[model samples]
Target: MDARAEHDSDTRAVSRAVSELARRTRFPIAFGGLAQGGAIHVSSIVGARTRSLDGLVVQETRGLGGRAFAEKRPRLALDYRTSRSITHDYDGQVLSEGIATLFAVPVLVSGRSRGVLYCGSWGQAGVGDVVARPAFAVAEELATELRVGEEVRRRLATMPPPATSDAMAPAMQEELRESFAELRSIASTVTDTAVRERLTKLEQRLAALSRPAGPAAEFDVRLSPRELDVLACAALGATNAEIAAELNLREGTVKSYLQSAMGKLEASTRHAAVAKARRAGILP
Candidate 1:
């Protein structure tokens, strides 16, 4: 995809994510990608139509999402709309959404916090681990996808111009696709999310190399990269603990990502998720 098309895809991906998250967790979900001046700007949401969250500027360390991004970890408050745990910069929106409890998770990429992913309830103390897991998993997947896009652009920038028409030939495309498979094979041995994200980017870059570089394929639906990983392993008949060991996360965490993925895929079981993802071209 060209730069402009890629940018649009990223926008759609984030926008779609909030709605998908809201549906999956049955809680109001919101997302704010980091922008200049070190602030996260809320631009997309689901189940928050009552609030004017669009362009709601959240300064660093100023709100729940801010604290999560600043601390590079998940932050939670049982009664956010009136809680003293965080500043009230965006409480207007929260109150508008009728959120009495809330939680935020940082979208960390390459050791840097890129933004915040949040979900909350209209009642006090309404969220718990089972609800939070898929949300965090979705955040992780977005971080990974963004990091991959960045790396692809970086690598393309470093490459010299094409010397001839043969530069992007079909034969070369096949070779690049092979490299993608190899990278996935190597990445399975890695454990760290950040590191695996880099490899995933490399694989994505290779796959892109195999396709025409004119424009990105129209991808209207957003899928979690981390979800695909877990589901892909499950497709291979790996157990939850085994997937967790390979992904360098706790077994329960793996389950949450899987559940979130299943919701996104509209599947009721691991096998069903794998099948749906395959049909959706989110898996191979």
Candidate 2:
């Protein structure tokens, strides 16, 4: 389909994600697209009334979303009104929405900010790292979909079928199908409910293009930088001993990081750690 159509579909997919996140999470959810004037405005809401908060645009370098977009990573606030690290220019909107605990993650594509995803806990603060992980988890999944969809659209534009032939060649058709299939597999493998729903839609689109195969599943599990590095090594079939050799970390430290990841994923072994990490979009 066209770009607008693709964008609309993605928007709906995000809406569904917000809904699912609201249902599964204790936080209120909001997704926002960065407008032309460098303002972040809420695009969808869940666990709260959907009203027009258009007047509340998170300006660049200001507010939670702006800081997220500026920093190009996730930001958390135990209390929005009292958070001193970031600007509170959107205090009116926060008050209107009755938001307290706030977490924001920037949605990036090729190192550029495209949007922001946020979760809020009303009346209470101190969401801690527990909520932070899941919030980043959702944002990362959404970013992947946006990136993949953009890539798919670009590929389609460059290789349209001849006027006298089918809409797509057999090989192209197969590629699309395979890509979609793999996308579906990745989506299915994700344990987080919100992530699964958003990815399912992206997978459907890719499948219609071909069998749905592309890059191996690369998920961002919001592990600390060191944890991510260790997981990457583990995914390559490195033993803790080998991982220690590569990273110059003690085997006990390597094992500890692995154990922490496994615990977060509720997994039982190193193999299960990799599997669960893959499923959670923490590792490729």
Candidate 3:
């Protein structure tokens, strides 16, 4: 995808995360945005009574959100109007929304801050473990989405265009298989339903890339998610033990998944199962 399309996709992920933050924490107000040009430009908001938060841009070291972004940690203002620890650069917009207390969490991906998320209330409320946990979870979820997108884009950049002939280059096929396995590994750990769905779509795209030319084949087999995950890892020449370690599954469990997938694909061996899956357009 182009840069503009990528940006829009990231923004949509952030917007969904902000909405989830509000729903999970029961916060009356939630708004957040991704970093661009060293600033967090607020792009998503929920449960706000006014347009004060619209077009809000937070720079590093400038306000509560900025401090959280710069420090790569969560910051809380039990009393927003009287907080001395943070600068009041955005108070005009913040206070206008009657947000008496605010909590800011930086969306950190691979140890770098990609964005900041904020949840607020109309009354003074201390952010204990109960309120803080869901906000952190939401930020982590968004961070995972950003991380996956970055990896996908990086892989796409290095990949060659689709082949005209029936056979793809061996190196290109290996890269696609690796990408498919990595995406499946990441998808296994994601808890959010929407994010998992997005990852699944990306997985499908990767699978379609290596699809055989000409009319599609008719296959009656359907592999479970775990079965597909095991098969994808196996396609990368990963041993059952190695797949277990990567997927946090027991060695026997990994074997079981692989055997199940092979049975479904009507293959006699793991290698055969992977080959059949690729031919069926089930793995990239």
Best by TM-score: 3
Query: TM-scores of the models, in the given order?
Result: 0.60, 0.59, 0.95
Candidate 2: lDDT of 36?
A: 42
Put down candidate 2 lDDT per residue, 75-177, tens digits, no spaces.
Answer: 8887778889888777877767777788777878678887777777776767666666666666666666666667656656655463344355655654443
Stretches of candidate 3 exceeding 4 Å from the true structure:
162-167
Off by over 4 Å in 1: 1-6, 166-284
The backbone clash count of each candidate, in order, is 0, 18, 0
- Clash count, predicted structure 1: 0
Candidate 2, position 93, lDDT: 76
Model 2: residues >4 Å from true position, as ranges? 29-31, 34-37, 49-55, 166-284
Scanning candidate 1 in windows of ten residues, the lowest lDDT window is 173-182
- The Cα local distance difference test for each model comes to 0.68, 0.64, 0.91
Tens digit of lDDT per residue, candidate 1, span 71-183? Answer: 99889888875678788887777777677778788888899887777787767755676778778767766776676567556545554554466466444433443334334
Ranking, TM-score, top scorer first: 3, 1, 2
Q: Could you tell me the C-alpha RMSD of candidate 2 in Å?
A: 11.4
